[model samples]
Target: MRTIIGWAVLLLATAWVGAVEIKRPVDMGFVPLRAVSYEEAVELCTPLLSKDGKLTYAKIKNLLVIHDYPENIEAVKKLLAQIDEDPVNVRVDIFMDQAAQEKSSSFDVNLRNVRVEHRDGHTRVDGGIGISAGQGSREMSGSTNPFIMAGNGRPARIWVGETVADPVWVYEYGMGQGWWKQELVNRDLGVSLWVLPRVLPNDLVEIEVYPRVTARGSTPLSVDVKELGTKVVVQNGATMPLGGLDSSRRDAYRRILGVGSVFNGSNLSISVRPTIMRMPERLRQEKARQDQPPEKH
Candidate 1:
C-alpha cells in the first residue's frame, strides 16, 4: 500500500513538470508602420497569430501593439518591413485637338445613257460622275497636365471641368389661367482622373487609370458620362498613352433666310508619366534617428 501511494505522488509531480514545460509565456511587441495602415497590418498578422495573440492599434501615434510569441512577433515585423516603401509620383497630361469641316463647294450634273455591269465580284460603270473634294482640317484644341503623389497602394484624384446651368421650363394650369415657371439646373462637364500607381522593386510601375468624362447628351436635359479605365504596366520614367475619348462641337447661324452649320470635332488622348522618387539613404538614416525614442537621463 505504501509503495502504491508513493508511486501516485511521483506520477503527479512528473505530470506537473510536463505541464509547465509545455506552456510558454506570451510576449509583447510594439511595431511602427510607415507606408501601410494599421488595419492592413492587423489583417496581415491575424493569420500568423497564435491562439493567445492579440493586436491593437494606437491611432494617435500610428503604432501597432502586438501581443504574441517572440517568434510570431518577429515574423510580423519582417512582413511589414517588406511592404514599407517610398511614395510614387505620377504626372498625367491630357491632349485634345479640334478639327473643323465645312461644305466648301459642290458640283452636280445630269447623266443619261449610263450602263453598269458586274463581273467577278467587281462593278464597272461606263459613265462619268461628278467629283468634288471636301476640305477638312484639324487644329490644336487644348491640353491639361496634372500631377499627383500618393503612397504605395493609395489613390489620388484630380478634376478638371466646368459647371453648366441648364434652364428648365414648366407650365402650370391655374383656375382659368396658365402660368409658366423657369428653373435653372446645374451640371458638371469635364474630366475626372483617378490614378493608382504601384512601384515594384524592379523599377517597374503598375498604374491604374480611370478617366471619366461628363458631357451633354442628345436631349437638352440629359447628361452623359463615360468611364474609360485601363491597367497599364510600364517602366519608370516612361509614358503610357490612353485614348478613346472623343468630343465635338457645332454652331449654327442664320443667313438672311438660310441656316448654315459649322461642325467641329476633337479626339482626346492622355499620357501618364510615373516617376519613382525614393528617399535618399542619408535622409532615411536621419529619419530613423529622429524616430528613435529619447534615452532616459
Candidate 2:
C-alpha cells in the first residue's frame, strides 16, 4: 500500500509538470459579424492563420469563430474591424470634347492669256482673264460634358453614335427569272466611352478608361474603328487628361490663293473626376453620441 501511494503521487506530479509544459490555444470568443459576410470574413482571415490556427462560423446566427495564437487572433480581429464597415460609394464625372477638321470654303484662282511687253525700259501688261472656283468641306465640331454615377469597381458606358440602314443586293439562283432587289441592313457608327473607377486608401482614386470610335470605311462592308485604353491614378475630385488620340490632316494648295496649306484636325480630349462619398463629421458625432450608453441616475 505504501509503495502504491508513492507511485501514484509521482505520477500525479509528472502529469502536472506535463500540463504546465504544454501551451493551449487561445479562443477569441464568437464575435457578431455585421457588415461583411461570413465567407468574406473567412477569406480575409485565412491568410493570417498560423499552422495550428482554426476558424469556424455560425451562418444562421451571423457569428464568427476564431481560434489561434493570441497575436494572430488579435490581428484577425483588427482586420475584421477595419473591413466590416459601410460600403464605399464612388461617383465619376466624365468630360469629353470631340472636334473634327473644319475646312472653310476653299477657292482656287488662275490667271490665263496674260501678255507682257517691255520696250525701251518701259513695261506694259495686257489684260488677263481671272477664274475662281471653290469647294466646301463637310465636317462638324462639338463639345459635351456628360456626368455619370456608379458604384466603386463597376463599369459605366456611354454611347454617342447613330444607326443607319445599309443596302444589300441578293440574286435568286433557283428561278430562271433574275430579280434585282435591295435590302436595308442596319449599321452602328459612333463612339463609346467606358469608365471604371476604384477608390483606394489615402484619398486617392484609380481609373480605367476605354474610348472607342467607329466610322464608315471606304467600302460598304468595311468599317473603321479606333480604340484607346489606359489606367491612371489621381486624387479625389481632380481631373486627369486622356492622351494619344489626336489626329490632323494637312491639304497643301501650292498655286491656289497663295495659301501655304490647309490644316484639318480631328481632336479628342477627355477629363475624368472621381468623387467618393464619405460620412459627414456632424453625422459621425451624432452617431457616436447615440452609441454611448445612457447615464445612470
Candidate 3:
C-alpha cells in the first residue's frame, strides 16, 4: 500500500512538472500610447510601418506621443499627412495588456486608449480603429461546395491573357461564407494567383480555379468544371501561391495578372492590392529545377 501511494505521488509530481514546463511567458498587453511631442511620436512609430505602407510585426517598445495641443493640431495633421504618405512605417499606439494580446494573436493592430490633449482641456476618447491579422487557414465545410463555376455548357479554359469578372466565393472557416462580387480573375501564365478565404499556419488546402464559358446556340449551361491545385501555406497573414516565391511575389503576381488581389484573414481585415498581369517564368523554371531529383554533378 505504501509503494502504491508513492507511485501516485510521483505521478502527480510529474504532471505538475509537465504543466509548469509548458507554461509560456504571458504576452503583456501592448505598450500603451502616451501623449508625446509630434516629433517624438513620429520617431517612435515610424519603424512600425514598412516602406510599402504596411505594418511591421515588430513590437513597439516606446510610447506614442500625439501633440494634441490645439495650437499643435495643424502641426500634428501635417506630421500625420507625411506619415500617411509613407504609411508603411507609421503605426498608431494603442494600450493592451498581456491577456488581450494573446487573445488577439492574429490581429495586426490594436487600439485601446485614445487621449486628446488640448490647451483648453484634455479629453480621453474611447474608440479607435483596430486591424487584426489575416486568417491563415482555409477549410471548406458545408452542404454546398465552395467553387467557382463557368457560365457556358462548354468546358471553359481560363487561359493566359483572359479576364474573368465574376462573383468570387470566399470560404471562411467557422463564419458563414460570403461572396465578393466582380472579382477580376486573370489567368496569366507564370503569374501568381491570390485566392480568398485566408489560410492558417500549417494548414493544407486544395484550391480550385474555374473558367466561365457560354454554350453555343444560346442553350443554358450548368456551372463549369474546376481545376485543382495545391495552395501555398501561409506563414503569417500573407503567402505566396506558387511554392518557392518570396513575400515580394505577392506584388509581382498582382503586376502580372492585371487583376486586383484581396485577402481576408481570421481577423476580418480585408487587404486589397491593385492588379498586375505577369509572373516571371524564370521563377517557375527555377522552382521546377529544384523540385526535380538531384542530378549527378
Candidate 4:
C-alpha cells in the first residue's frame, strides 16, 4: 500500500511541470533541503517542482575585491553600482577563468554579515548563515564556507564567482519486499527530503538536503550519494554578502563556493555537490592577463 501511494505522489509531481520556456520577471522561490539519511531527502524530492512546470535561472555575478589595488576603493564602489544599477542582469568582470566558471544550479541564499579579517598572517574570513527551514544535520562536515580571494590573503582580494546546488528528483521502484528472515541487512544511504509549498509567487522558500549512508561494522560498502544539492527562493531585490571558510592554498585565506567540485569522503562514499564558478569573470581576467607585459621574472 505504501509503495502504491509513493508512486501516486511521484506521478502527480511530474504532471505539475509546465512544458515551456521559463519567463521573467519570474515568480521564483529558493528552496534549501537537508537530509541525514537518503530516505529522508528523497521523501521531499518525489514531488518537487511538479506544480510549476516552468523553471528559470537567475544570473548572479560574484565580486572579488583586492583592497590593495590602486583601484580598490573605486572597485568596491563600482561593484556596488553595478549591483545597484540593474539588481537583475548585474555586470562585474571576474579576472580569472579558473576563478569563476559555471556548470549550473545553485542553493545558498541566506548569506549575511560577511567580512575578511587578518589572523596569524593569513587572511581569515568569518560569516554565519541561518536556514529558515528543514532541520538539517550539522554532522555532514564539508566546506559550506565561501571561497576565499587567495585562500592565503596574498595578492589579497575578496573574489566572487558563481556557486549553486539545486535538487533534481527522487523516485524509487521497490525491487522486492523486505525478507521476514534476512541473514544480513545494511543501509548504505539513509536520507529524507522535506518540501514546503509556495503560498505565493514571491515566497522565501529554503530547502536543506544531505545524504546519510552507513554500513554495519565489517560490512564492506560502496555507494555514491547522488545529486545532493540546495534550492533557494528569495524576495525581489535581495542580495546576500558572501565569504567562505576553507583553505584554498597554503598561507592563503580563501573559500571556494563555486560548483562542479566534490566533497570526497574516505568511507568508500563520495558526495557530489556542484560548486559555483563564473564565466564572464574568467574571460575578463584572461583579457587582462594577455594585455599584461611579459613577466620580468
Candidate 5:
C-alpha cells in the first residue's frame, strides 16, 4: 500500500511539473532612453530596445509621422520656412489593456500636439523617442494541453493532417530570453502553445526559452494529438510549451482543436507579428508596415 501511494504521488508530481503556467509575461513596457530630443535622437536608437526594436520603432515612427511630425509633411515644410518657430510638443502616452498576457501585450502611446521649439537655429523634431517592447494588443483564444495541429501556425485541416501541415513553428522570444519561463514547481512541466513560421521546409530553430528549458526534455516534444482528435497520429513538436495554460485562453484552444475536426472543431487563426517573425513572411510584413498608416486607438 505504501508503494502504491508513493507511485501515485510520483505521477502526480510529474504531471504537475509538466503542466503549463504563465511565467512572468513578456515585459511589454516602455524602455525609457536618456530622453534625447527629436533632432538629437539619432536614427531612432533602434539598437537600445529589448529585442529588435525595428517594428516597434516603425509603429512609433508611424504615430509621429501621422499625427506629430512628417505625417503632415506639408506642415513640416511650412515650419522649416519659419526661423524661430513656436514650441511644438507631442506628448506620447499610449495606453492598452493587457490583451495577450501570455504571448505578448501592448499599450497606447498618446500623440499630443507637436511642440515646435526652434533650438540652436533648428526646429527640433517635436518630441523625443521612446520604445515599448512587446507593444501590441492581442485578443487571445483557446487553451489546451499544447495540442496544436502541426502546420503553418494556422488551423490544420482535420482530414489532411501533417500532409497539408507546415512541419514547424518558429518563435523568437529573445526579448525576455533570460528570465521568461522560470521553473515554477520542482517538477513543473506546463506547456504553452507557440506556433512559429516556416522559414525553410522544416525550420525548428528555437532559441532557449529559459536557460534550463531543456530540462523539460526536447525542443519539439513529440506527444499524442489523438487527444485533440486528429488522424495526424501525433503532435510533431511544432507547438512548444511555454507556460501553464490558464482559464483565459480556454476558448481559443477549443477552436484550434475543433478547426481540423470536420464535425466540430474551432479553426486556429492568429495574426503573426511580422516584426517578430522570420523571412518571407517578414518581408511581407515589412512591406505591409511601410504601406500602412499609424494605428488608431
Candidate 6:
C-alpha cells in the first residue's frame, strides 16, 4: 500500500510539471497590419519548447506577448530555427489560445514537429504552422480601346466619340479653325479614328479627352482629362489645344499644312459619351441602402 501511494504522488508531480501554463498578451503597436490565428502561434513555437521540454517561464510569457501569431508565423519560424541551432546562446517560447489549439488539432495526420539545434558557429530553427478563415474571392470584367493618328502636312483633324450606358467624349484637332469629329464604334470601350491624306508632311499631332462620369443618383456629370505627356489637368469647361503650335504664323501654317511644298496629311480624333436611362427612384434608394453598412441588430 505504501508503494502504491508513493507511485501516485510521483505521477501527480510529473503531471503538474508537464501541465505548466503560460499566458501573456501580445501588443501590435497602433494599426496592426495583420492578425495571426492561434494555430500559427503553436506551429511557430512548438519546436523551441515541446509539450514537456525545459523552458524559462518568463521567456515563454515574452514570446506570447510579442509574437503576432500566424500572421507572423513565417518570421517566427525562421527566428526559432536560428535559436534552436544555436541553443547554447539562444532561447524561444510560444503559447497559443486553447481555441486555436483545438482548431489546429487533427487526427490521423503526420503532425510536423518544430526543430531546434545548434551547429558549428550557428543556431537553427525550422518548421511553421498557419491558420486561415473568412476568405472570399471575386471577379470583374471590362475593356478599353486607345487609338493614335499622325499628319504629314495640311491642317488635319479627327473626331471620335462614344455612346454607352455612361459615356465620355474626347478628340484632337489642329490649334486653328477646324475641329475633328469621332464616331463611337463600340458602346463598351469608346471610339477611335485614323484619318490620313496622301500628301503633305508636318509635325506630330496629339489629343487627350475623357468621358463624363456621373453616379446613379448624382447631380450633373463631370469630366476629367489628363494632358498628354504632361501632368496638366483639363476639365469640361476648359479649352485645350490639340498640340502647341510654333509662334511664327508662317511656321504654324507650314506645320499645319505639312512642311513639304505640296502638303498632305491625316488627323485623328476620339470621344466617349454615355447613354444613361434613369431607373426607378425606389430601385435607386434600394441600391443605396444595400451599399450602406447593415444596422446593428
Candidates by TM-score, descending order: 1, 2, 3, 4, 6, 5
Candidate 4, residues 95-178, lDDT tens digits: the string is 111222223433545867878898889997679775554333222223223222211101222333222232333444457743
- CA shift of 191, model 6, Å: 13
Local lDDT at 8 for model 1:
100
lDDT of each: 0.66, 0.68, 0.33, 0.30, 0.31, 0.32
- Per-residue lDDT tens digits for candidate 2, residues 57-101, read 876656687777877888888888887764466677766555566
lDDT at position 154, candidate 6: 17
- lDDT by residue for model 6 (57-130), tens: 12322233223333344454465445332011101010101111111323342325779899997988787655
Q: Identify the leading candidate in terms of lDDT.
A: 2
1-297 per-residue lDDT for model 1 (tens digits): 999999999999999998885587887777766777878888888987887788988776566878899988988888877876433454433332233343355454656568999999999888766555455443434444556776657887666678989998889999999999999989888766667887776888888867666878998779999765668887888887754433321111011112122323333345667777777889878766654533435
lDDT of 5: 0.31
TM-scores of all candidate predictions against the true structure:
0.55, 0.43, 0.17, 0.16, 0.15, 0.16
lDDT of 5 by residue, 119-238 (tens): 789876675545455544335443223212222322222121222222444444776563234332223233223333222233332211111111223354433221211111112233
For model 3, residues 84-200, the per-residue Cα lDDT tens digits are: 311011111111111111122365777766666555575556668788666454342111112122211112222333333444555445556664544444332333232332222
Residue 153 lDDT in model 1? 70
Worst 10 residues of 2 by lDDT: 248-257
Q: Which residues of candidate 2, in runs, are more than 4 Å off?
A: 1-40, 47-75, 82-86, 102-134, 148-194, 200-202, 211-228, 246-265, 281-297
Clashing residue pairs in candidate 2 (N, C-alpha, C atoms within 3 angstroms)? none
Q: Model 6 compared with the native: what TM-score?
A: 0.16
Taking all chains together, the TM-score of candidate 3 against the true structure is 0.17
Per-model root-mean-square deviation over C-alphas: 18.8, 17.5, 34.3, 30.0, 35.3, 42.3
Find the candidate with the highest TM-score and give its number.
1
Runs in model 3 with CA error above 4 Å? Answer: 24-56, 59-297
RMSD of 1: 18.8
Count of residue pairs whose backbone atoms collide, per candidate = 0, 0, 37, 67, 43, 43
Locate the minimum summed-lDDT window of 10 residues in model 6: 86-95
Please identify which of the two predictions, 3 or 5, would achieve the higher lDDT against the true structure: 3
